[model samples]
Target: MKKAVFLDRDGVLNEVLTERVKFVNRPDDLYLLEGAAEAVAELTKAGFDVFIVTNQGGVGLGFMKERDLKKIHGRLEELILEKGGAIREAAYCPHKPKAGCECRKPNPGMLLDLARRHDIDLSASVMAGDHERDIEAGKKAGCKTVFIGEGETSADAKAPSLQAAVKDILQLLAD
Candidate 1:
């Protein structure tokens, strides 16, 4: 089985908006968070296959179209590739919370699907994100989840930034 790194999109890869940006249907609205490119590059160099699992309910809410989300992902991919990193795949939940979708985070549908398709070693893998939901999803998927937020995690590890998290992962993998 192959090890992988699962990442959250918004706060992990790009700036988490103070207010949710509606109609992120455009590449122009998608922007990278600080140190995101460098951190991804380091992760790539560490030989982890990177994947993004995001919850984009804006589509279900009609705030943005699916095509717009695709464009945003394309832009993100382009930027990552430019930085010498590559995202092997990206999956998202487009359903609203009211839809009760299985694919949403806190459910682990997307991560399970990715693991099935990619033959991922869940135990050896890591999930990094800025939200508790992301950590919950990773736990459900049986991956070592890291919370990329302010508080220290009793459930998983926590880091204030992606760069710091990657550094920790690097040291662990090196050992």
Candidate 2:
């Protein structure tokens, strides 16, 4: 089985001054958060396959098209590669919140699917994001969880930024 790190895309990896933009609705609106690329690089270098698991309900709500979201992930991949880090793949739930989809955050579907497809060992993996649902998903998937940003959650660990959370994320492997 392989070790992996499942990361949330929007608030955790890339965003445009989160306070200003709630979501990246346009293909060209994506931007990597400060030190996010490096943080990811460190994880990949540490011998983990990285994957992006996100909830992109705007497509389901008609706010954006599926292709638009694809473009955003494409750009993100380009940017990360430029910084020497690469995401193995990205899987998003293009359904609206509470649409009863299994792939959405707070549910383990996405993580579970990826783990199955990639031969990943969930118990040896870590999931990090800026919301409680991300942690919840990790818990449901049997992976260690790291909470990013602020607010409240029962995450296994918490940090102010993805970069800052690197140590905490790695610690999960030790325990």
Candidate 3:
């Protein structure tokens, strides 16, 4: 029964394109938010298995190719490792928003799968993200939830940024 932290990819791990309000469509568009790597490293050092659960609907909308998304994730992993972090795995929903996909955010499919494969304890796990859908997924998956950024959400906790969120999560784990 290992603990795990599931993170949202876009706003949680990287800077989302604010002007366009969309996912990073290319590797060039990808930018790791400040302190993100260090925060992840801290979580990794805390002994929690880190994972990414995201809804990459851009692939289904033809905004980006699967290979391009892979490239972005590859670079992200490299950056995290460079900062002394370890990501156990990443799972994403490539279907369109209205595709009724089981793996999308707001659904527990991805989290459930990760728990099954990694033998994770859902009760001891945490899900951190910037959107309500992320919180919803976590709740449905039976894990505590952390919401990043300012907003009205049903998350168990809230923070101004991913770094802050991770710190709060660490405290929760300690308790």
Q: lDDT by residue for model 2 over 1-175, one digit each (tens)?
A: 9889999998889885566576798756887889999998988888888999999988999999999988889889888888888899999999998799899989999999999999999998999989899999999999999999888889989999999999998888667
Which residue window of length 10 is worst by lDDT in model 2? 14-23
Runs in model 2 lying further than 4 Å from the true structure: 16-20
Q: Model 3 lDDT vs. the true structure?
A: 0.90
Segments in model 3 whose C-alpha atoms lie over 4 Å from true places: 19-22
TM-score of each: 0.92, 0.95, 0.95
* RMSD, candidate 2, Å: 1.3
lDDT of 1 by residue, 29-68 (tens): 8778778878888899878889999999989988889898
Cα error, residue 22 of model 1, in Å, equals: 6.7
lDDT of 3 by residue, 1-175 (tens): 8889999999889988676445688877878888899989999998888999999998999999999999988889999999999888989999999999789989999999999999999888899999999999999999999999996999989998888888789876665
